[model samples]
Target: MTETAHPAVSAEQAGIEQALTDQVVASFDGTPDPRLRQLMQALTRHLHAFIREVRLTEEEWNTAIEFLTAAGHITDDRRQEFILLSDVLGASMQTIAVNNEAVPGAERAATEATVFGPFFVDDAPEIPIGGDIAGGAHGQPCWVEGTVTDTRGNPIPGARIEVWEADDEGFYDVQYTDGRVAGRAHLYSDEEGRYAFWGLTPTPYPIPHDGPVGKMLAATNRSPVRASHLHFMVTAPGLRTLVTHIFVQGDPQIEIGDSVFGVKDSLIKDFDVQHAGTPTPDGRALGGDWARTRFDIVLAPAGA
Candidate 1:
């Protein structure tokens, strides 16, 4: 029987390779923030592991770098290609999931949060409780009513209920070249935590595919269509602010896939269609066919 010894050169090469990653990790040791130092080291380790596992080619690496560079170049105040990138890749949703835990059994579930798409604007034309947020945008007239309540089913009075969405034409006000603001508004809940507003039934829209995110989706043979849904951002004192969507039930695009992966079964609701001359719940007259949807929201206590 014979015993074999490992080559010294192989061991040396392995140590050298490991040292390269260790050196980078060690460079972050002096970071004043302990959390930052840990994050940097962890990120470095995972990044190196990925590179090593892939045995990445120089050309492929350069292509990736160029792609990222182009993503930065196309980003602007109005167009956030980076956020779009994160969204399409599902990183944003994963981060939200990590931070938003589910309520345990025997307790009411808090409303699920989703990606805050880049189109939301501040000071979105505050309106009366029953006022129209759509500003006569070209879409089917829709009445949206909801109640903001705590997880225990208690009304949260005076909560801010903000709503925004694309029109029937599948374009948000921000997407207009004329700098117009439409299809979005904000209002406060009534004494009973009830909120109501006139808005267009959201239609399926393409997630701005003219930029790097669109290019990425095209390269990967994926669709950029987001499911039809209305965006809501609800806030109240002593409760966690919830950014979510009430998606239209039976939307074909949702069955396909939401580009941002923001869809949840609990968030889906029916947008009932009513014909002309039908009396609305709020006593508003409809000259033509319209849609109506009711979505009640549940908020968790702060830090819940």
Candidate 2:
């Protein structure tokens, strides 16, 4: 008696896709959830199709691997280089826009969602209205006054609008390296649904480029700067959350050339500075005859 042993169906160059698909599908048993099974099957088909369509080379794939690895290694406790990767590529904003399908006439969602950078310190002081948020001894005097209201045109009492931004020197609290939390405040709307604060007019600032994000920019011959804007995160009971920024009008740094694709016509606001001798938002003392500005914000409802 004689027996024959066959080399188990080897994947020849003629059938690369079938070989790849078979290997991928064989790993998942036939009893997995139908949705998961469908997703994996679709992913496998598209991925293999892409490889065949592009005729990808090993070198290209390896380079992508290295890129993802480097991006991973660059992220840390305070800095998220991966998020930056998604940001500069506009993936972050795109995802937000896709998920935020507000009704057609729903107050236009108040404002557009912008990038949430890496440096937000929690639990800012809930100071009184017209109180100052800027750390003492930094930035010019800009009185930021505004009412916080829901999409229904009603005020949002107790709504906390967390405020933060870089200093006039283009540095944030966490960037000091001296361990400080300046120029950041957490303010709650008063009973009238109003919030006011005094601070310096924000300036266009560059992202930390001595890091991975910086490396990515240099590698791509792109800039590492963001348009000048004050950051805000508004939260109220039963209200839709808002992540936004008020772009300074007429800032040369914020042209069509914003490196991260974060600029929008709607987000840009006027930073009208009231010179020394001009009345303040509340007729308070213009300490040392300083500058003043205002930015009123509108919020969208949770259902909106």
Candidate 3:
């Protein structure tokens, strides 16, 4: 028996798809802001290219729309599902890389920036130097000390440093419903540019995995766990704001993979263990084992 011949896709069909993409991109030509017009056109072109490359079906498109809708529905002031989705997709890290490129003519390297995870909040309680930020979060206490300095090695006095992290159980303050503020706070560097705080020892934890983003990760057979880390956002006058994380050295999750792709070799540090009954740096009475780590942060000049 002779097999039936199948016709190839017509050139007219390909032309129609290209014309549609061109029309969508051109629709943004009237945008008043040049940057906005460029962004819109680029986004339209890339998005249309993706759809065409995938040859997406109507069912798949509907599923994607439903997934995004679910993510929006689950988002609130306390939890941002969109950011989580971006993190799992590595979009957040890519944006950070694009915006935080290296500074030219710098004598010393600045601390690398990473994804500003979904848990940051405005107006965190301010604590004095060497104060505790753990509030009431449960975990082994960690003494986080660091000096804020410019690329030239000059101290940056009075820089504002914001710190936030997950507790031993991998839960952030916002994850709880009792209006608790633990494992997070802000502090200013001292006159000598030294800042220290008490926070939980970084521990590997899964990203909030009960939402649409989590579902996607699960469906794709990917783990949602992030490497053990402590978040920092440091700002000073006339310096580029720095947002990054100091990951625990030797965390297995780092080798496995950080779901958000936020790890950098330069950002990893050793968390030294202090056995019980050891004297604390500030002579605070801690009756149990604790950890300590120092992170010296160098900031780039504002326009650098």
Candidate 4:
């Protein structure tokens, strides 16, 4: 049997496509900011290349526009669908990696950084050292203790530490409608660079899946479940701000894969189980068992 011959693309058609990409890229030449010009031109080139490489159909383009529109429509102060989209796409983690590359041969290695998920709030309630960040969120109580130090081992007293996590039900307080602020707080380190708090033990939870990003994940056969972990953002004067998470050691999802690609082996820590009737660190009475984990954070110099 003879194979049927396919029509070849005319030279003019190929030239037209290349010319369009060139024109779009050149349009950014007059941008006032040099960095903006570079970024726009590069973006245009890559975006056009993708469209051409995929031979994208008009219908598919329309569907993409609609998806982005829906994402914007669902976004609000409490819900950041754009960031969610970035996270699921691995762009968030990639950006973090690019910006937080480790310095070679440094005396002390700073803690690694990771994706900052969408649930963080700027005005998290202030908690005293060793205070409760659970804020009525439901979960097994956990004692989280840590120290903040410079890469050289100098303690960074008064470093601001923000902590947040989802409750056992796999939902943040912001996911609720009653204006709750549970499972999140900020506290300052003590003179010894030590900080501690009562928080919910981290548990594996699915990222919110009721929006456009979720639909995209479903269509792509991707899981939206993140590994169990607690978020931390530490900041101090003259030090690089660190945004990272301490994952639960042996979390099955680590091997399975974190949807946001936020897991780092160095950040995983043991969440030790305390049996029922175990003594509480601050002598708080609890009817059942709890957990404890320690994470010592090292920050790099801002100029590093």
Candidate 5:
């Protein structure tokens, strides 16, 4: 018995794919930035390869274009449908990974980075240390305390800590039709590099699904839920700013996988559920059972 050999490509189709890829890449030569030109050329090659590999049809291409157009139309100041699109597709996470990677022989560990979701508002209300940032949102009250330290363990004073999260109901302040802002604030570290504030326990929440990203999720049979976590954007004058979240260690959504692919094991922390009688670090009494979390951030030197 003998096996048949595959046929060679016809002369007409030979090099056609390469020629198209080359032509598209060549068009990027005029890009002013050398890095931009390189990226455009590489992207062109990969994009063309995907089209060819999928044997994409004209109708399918049109549908994709229409989907993107819808995403753009639905985007606005409050709603960032494009970032949501990138998040759900894991592009945002991939870009974060590439840009925030640690060096192989770095002296110390730097806080891991993650996606910055669309809910963040500019100039979130600044609160005093130990003050509540939740603004009486609907959720169990909890204390968030942490220190900002350099790679060598020295405390960094006056580090800006920008925090935000969804309430227990999985709705952020922006989602409220009443135009109220809650569950977000900015605070500064004290002389000891320590910061503490009252915030609601993080709860699993679904990304905005009323837009095109929602349609995409439905079409692909994917959930629009992100894991329970609190977002933080920490920055110090001489250190690299760290944008990340502290995920609930045992949240079921962690196993289910985050819709935005933002969870990292290093960022997972125990949200210690406590009874009402328990005393908080600030000598405050809880109205009921609530959660508590401690996260110490380590920042790398700028340009490191």
Candidate 6:
């Protein structure tokens, strides 16, 4: 007895891909929306081309599937591994660049925006307007005070500034052995647009290296880290909000080689130590004196 011939696996792949393309085109064939049509067509072309360019073998494709599974496995309420994956690839910044492009002098009558790092802890303890975010401990003893202004150069009273920064040890409050949430704080701008908070200069540090994101960085031999920075989002109703970081200028990582690609010259600032005798805010002691840096932020109108 003899067996009949069976269809080759390669032939099956070719047929399925062609069928998939035909279906996609047929579904969009009479779409009258120009923008929608353009997006769909461009996506199809790039996706199909990508498959061809990579000559993606079934084994390689399976590996990709498994990688995604692992990625999901590493994510939960406190950590988002996929976002970390995107950060290392620079895709997150590119997306922001396209969406919130600061238009010269018209940069939104709101504060600037920056990356929402994977470290924000939900439900951070609410503290008084001038309370110490440094949690009664000490590092660089920085008095960060500033004003929120609009594009037309007017003050935006009542704007809220949510700020978070790692300690001098390069670890955030959430990462402390005490398992506490204190380094983060929310302060509302007072009339005349003044907002002040007491804290330490955040030190430059590395991103998490316990997952696939770490493996990706290692394979490329590129460091996974960021410069010293304080993350902030200054928001006011009817104004464009800014999600950005204030960089400590002394950190070499903020130069052209920032591992996370987050440094902007406009956002870089010097946090010099002030050794003269300056009084610490109510109820706190400065030992001798403390460090201070004044940063003023301007916001643009929502549509600007």
Per-residue error for 181 in candidate 2, Å, reads: 0.8
**Local accuracy of candidate 5 as per-residue lDDT tens digits, 9-96:** 4544536766777788889989999999988888887788777666678999999999899999988878899999999999999998
lDDT of 6 by residue, 1-304 (tens): 1111123436666667667665775677677997888788667756665665566789988987887888899898667889888888888888877778665755433444667788887666555566678774446778888888887778889898888888776777765567777678887888898888887877778887788888878988988778888888778998777888888877778764766777777788888776756666555666665777778998767766
Roughly what TM-score does model 4 have, to 2 decimal places? 0.95
Candidate achieving the largest TM-score = 3
Candidate with better TM-score, 1 vs 4 = 4
**What's each prediction's TM-score?**
0.93, 0.82, 0.96, 0.95, 0.94, 0.83
Better of 3 and 5 by TM-score: 3
Off by over 4 Å in 2: 1-15, 18-56, 107-109, 283-291
Better of 4 and 6 by lDDT: 4
lDDT of 2 by residue, 1-304 (tens): 0111123423465365566566786666584598888778777767766666566789989977887887787777767777787888887778767755564675534767777777777776666778787776377777787788765667778888898888988888877767676788887888888878887788877887876667778998998888887889988877778887788889887764676677777888887766677777677776555654455666766766
Per-residue lDDT value at 9 in model 1: 31
Two-way lDDT contest, 2 vs 3, winner: 3
Error of 1 at 215 (Å): 1.3
Clashing residue pairs in candidate 5 (N, C-alpha, C atoms within 3 angstroms) = none
Clashes of each: 0, 1, 0, 0, 0, 14
- Please give the distance, in angstroms, between residue 48's alpha carbon in candidate 6 and its true position after superposition: 2.5
Worst 10 residues of 1 by lDDT: 1-10
For model 1, the stretches where C-alpha displacement exceeds 4 angstroms are 1-14
RMSD after CA superposition, every candidate: 4.4, 6.9, 4.6, 4.3, 4.0, 6.7
In order, the Cα lDDT scores of the candidates are: 0.87, 0.74, 0.91, 0.91, 0.88, 0.75
Flag regions of model 3 displaced more than 4 Å: 1-8
